[model samples]
Target: MNATEKFYLPVDGIFDMFTSLTSPSAVTHPVVQSAVAPQQHPKAPSFSKTGMGIIRMVKESWRQPMAHRSSSSSTGRQLSIERQAKRSVDLLELGLAKPKNCHRIVVLGAARVGKTNILQRFLGNDFDESYAPTAEDFHRKLFHIGGDAYQVDLLDAASERNFPAKRRLSILTGDTFLLVFSLDDRESLHHVRDMLDEIAAAKAKLLKLKHPAKVPAVICGNKADLTSPGAVTRSEVTQALGKDVTYFETSAKDGTGLEGAFRALAALGGLPDETSPSRHQLISLLSYQTLCISQRGRGGLRARGHGAPCAAMDPLARRPSFTSDLRLLLKSGSNKNNKPEMCHVQ
Candidate 1:
């Protein structure tokens, strides 16, 4: 038989092709012999032209479904390849562009002002009262929304004013800043004011701009639960930070006001609205991967509630890089090929 010729199975043996029947010789049905050798047996009843046409029709029917399956598989593979190529191109273009979906948020505050606690609340964690001074902490939150991933990098800096260089570098690299002050501490409020000035000065110097650049910042008055006689009033804090600045009174212990503050922060930084703490669901890394895979499947996907799915990476998994930040900031400008000076922390 020619390779291109169709395999014509006997009427009774047609179904066996789908069953345990493998090769043509494996079909032991008597109909197979009758189909092939009508001239050999004189006692056998001869089939009419109509009956023979029906058998050919059945054979063609089986071939059609098999061809359809093969065609469908090829189409699926082509779609998969196109998706991967498009994704790769998008990532490459993103890398070439500055300010990728990931934005760094630097939190600045005086010691014991609940800066870390506020960040903890934003990350969907319980507040801890422990007073261990933080040297520096970095955290990343991944939000999966609209079939894309956006990252928010939170840098919790130490309150020590000794390393002005490190502080200045943080200011220069930060996409947005969160200035926290304790409501019960008047000095903490003063520290926030100083940091604001530092941020403005550092950005102006680094960008070589004559006018102060508009830095995206959110001021938080923490320790709202504490009411001290000498505490800074809301009106006074507003006056000190400037009325134009976005401000919030938050109690990390009570978990109040943090959500709104985070939403405002996300808005100011030009991040997706779903990056807001209240707008996304907290999921484990494993669940995040599973959901991402499901979203990429060919089957139509339905949204899970109104919230976007999110996951948090280990805080210590990635260290902050000044060189990388400087590159990103410089690339964000029109001069893409310019080599910038390294932001020396020491």
Candidate 2:
């Protein structure tokens, strides 16, 4: 059939053996032999309200950053202002007041790629050996990076071979994206490219804007702990996926790179830096918070363990955290025609 030919799909077979492409010239739907020519008006598919709501939420959260500072004489201040101005308006901070914070990250990839395992390990610090199919799930995690309140949400989307259309649609809610793929299954990597295409189309439709999306994304290669000698390397990952993205190797089972991946996404959405919180500053914050808690007579805190409840409960628990610029865009591979782009963190 011709590329522009309008084909009909059966109501029953539509759910199976069918996938849509965002490319205008690509096949939009499966074609059946017994089907008649499609009507002039293409029937709009029944979309899940939650799926659309998530898309709108992401679009709305990505707004023009407010003018946090009017002027600063030094080049450092000017650079800071310019950088902050590129972020979302929702991240604006008040003078000496509570820090305004939020970030939504959606993890997506093919089935059995350890999507759930990643979240489970990162948030609950646990892992499961059993495989349980999920359509869609959302979990909110509260984090304090450098004395700022950052509420992060991780959306685990169903990526099963039969993953429902609605669930796949809802994963678009991320301010940042984690394109999770398996190191063992190279085919899973193709899903990342397809998803990128889908996301680009979805963003254009939701925002009603012509400009390209500036949302940061991370390419997470899961099951790295199980990878053998022939596994892909970080350099290969950078070469395969270039620009507006970062790459990480994670193993959900042993919790390798889980925290770093989580913190990395949070930073993309304007969270605390991954390399921040120097030893001295962290020590000072702990000491100060400990003293305040002791004075308040709420002293169940122990000398050891920063993971104690005291860290979360104390009013002075927040500390100064640097916001690193994770503009981790890999311009192009060294073998490519283009020159290498420097990776900058401010």
Candidate 1 off by > 4 Å: 1-99, 293-308, 329-346
The residue-by-residue lDDT of candidate 1 on 127-229, one tens digit each, is 9988788854877776676656566778876554687776766776788999899988889899889888878877876676798766689998998888688
Residue pairs clashing in model 1 are: none
Best by TM-score: 1
- Candidate 2: deviation at residue 166, Å? 3.3
State the C-alpha lDDT per candidate: 0.68, 0.53
Residue 241 lDDT in model 2? 67
- State the local distance difference test value for candidate 1: 0.68
Candidate 2 residues 190-210, lDDT tens each? Answer: 777677666666555445458
Off by over 4 Å in 2: 1-100, 144-148, 159-172, 233-236, 273-346
TM-score versus the correct structure, for each prediction: 0.64, 0.47
lDDT of 1 at 297: 61
